[model samples]
Target: MKAVRTVAMLALCVLNADVPLNAADAAAVFPDGAKLELLWSDGEFTEGVASSPQGDIYFSDIAGKTPGRILKFDPKTKTTTVHCADSKKSNGLTFDLQGRLIACCGAAGGIQSVCEVLDSGELKPLVSEFEGKRLNAPNDLDIHPRGWIYFSDPRYGGPEPIEIDHLSVYRFDPRTGDVVRVTRDITKPNGVALSPDASTLYVAETDNGFPEVPGAGSGGGKVHMTLNAFPVDRHGNLGERRILKDFGKETGVDGLTVDSEGRIFAAVRAESRFGIGVYDSTGRELAFLKTPEVPTNCGFGRGDDGSTLYITAGKSLYRIPTESRGWFLTGQTVP
Candidate 1:
């Protein structure tokens, strides 16, 4: 694998790092003179960035003709290596409480489910079909503290026929091996994230007017792009959703991560302002860090590098030092 290094000149605009302005909150999320450093830029479509327990960065490269690859970046060695060569088009990845790597691996002609990627690079399928029918495509996911896996299922474009009617979010219980449809209210859900305390579930509704149909040029009707907050119950159920931020006619968020304070760091794809948008849990914009390309996903490192934020955009991976640390349910246990 090849790696590239470039300094990303950032346009920083930070208001409040946290809700209440303390001595620490007074400091901007991006430290003074902070900039994005390009780590690698040789992917087809980079997505699903997650920091391992060892502080190593892992992201997916969704290929066009070949199977997706999960690449790992070591901050100490400063090298990029292939973690999984045949990822089955894995999109979103996270580590469970037991320090196991869980991934949403289902794209066009892909695995079509959320599975656990073992140390031997083998996939252990957790859930493939929701009911009796196969899922459209597992896109992104976040695990709850209680071991429930919440993921998004939406088909953007593919030659295969759509099995499920609605593009929705589903939650799978690994203990019981049961899958439950969390909600199908969104037009097309792209990213799914849980709050630090597991009280709120943030879902990014990025509808880009489905793929090309035989008769119609662009099939799926109206496009609704927005970031929503859904209240999550103790039983892993979702309540009425509240539209947090509406992008109107522009492309919305792709993937997002929450900090320890529950602040959302979203990969906004708005053509007018493409970058990472940091917002409070109540939908208030807190900061914005512009990227060289349209970002797909973002995650924060752990341990000594906990303040560094890793971003995946276009075909490149970028990182910047931030004042905030990522919130992980599993603590800092290494697998």
Candidate 2:
């Protein structure tokens, strides 16, 4: 009976989804006129969207002054449930090769920096402290096909003191639990994604915590938004960085994903032009899919041929149909 009710609820939610996106005419990656359907919206701010092994979706609700929580959605039941009461205010999340949920947690309140969500729903610190100091609030994270976990530690609108001097990106080896600083080149790095072939690394540079530039939007001289790509060295270090696209002062890129074909899907939070922008490997803007609000992050749903995308924007979570499967879904997650 509970399952039945859940299914019914899901049906009703779909039928009444806020900001419905019609994808019947959807074609390729950009899928012009694709519908961006609102799926859930009960949180203060949602992030950390990911598809689980069970083909379910999970997201985070960092309620600022309140205790952070993690929410999971079971597509089979078409229901949403609370997976964790205290989520350490995580921002970006993704599952590892070992099938464990890894998160760049503790964005707002004081908690673990980066942790692994255990089967018991407990939080296990993966790389919380660097050199004896708690890491700056980790904003986003991604795993390499070789099992190395790479994350960005950027302080974006949190009251926590900046423990780490520079806003940088880091890599952690799960097997040895060793961490290496990837780069601090970007003034503010918010999103980190590996290419489908795992040889290229892409980072989204956004000034979420800096003073905005005059023409660079509303803040002081803080936000220099752009998409950058770097070559992955043979020894696992990032090579020279290349500018993919620069948004000047317009909103900056937040979290981003890549499709099986190495195309980049970026969740752009540029207020006036907020939405997801799809670009090819060379950083050419191939297509633009607009979301109703400022999007934070995105992840494709389950199955090897999954074509559904789950997006986290502001206080709501939305979904839209996609024409291609995500990198992981294509069975090419790692080297």
At residue 311, what lDDT does model 1 achieve? 94
In model 1, the runs with Cα more than 4 Å from the true position are 1-27, 211-219, 331-335
Q: Which stretch of 10 consecutive residues in model 2 shows the poorest summed lDDT?
A: 7-16
- Model 1 per-residue lDDT tens digits across residues 1-335: 56544424454444323334333432557787676888888889999998888788889999989888888898887788888889988999988877888888876768788989888787888888977878877999998878888999888866777767677899888989889988867878889888888889999998888753333223456678999999998888999999999999899999999999899999999988888888888887767777888999999999999999999999988888998999987643212
Output the number of the lDDT-best candidate.
1
| Decoy 1 TM-score against native | 0.90
Q: Candidate 2, residues 70-155: lDDT per residue as tens digits?
A: 88876655667788878888778899887788878865574747888887778898888777777877878888877888898766
Clashes of each: 0, 12
TM-score of each: 0.90, 0.86
Could you tell me how far off, in angstroms, the CA of residue 99 lies in candidate 1 after the best superposition? 0.9
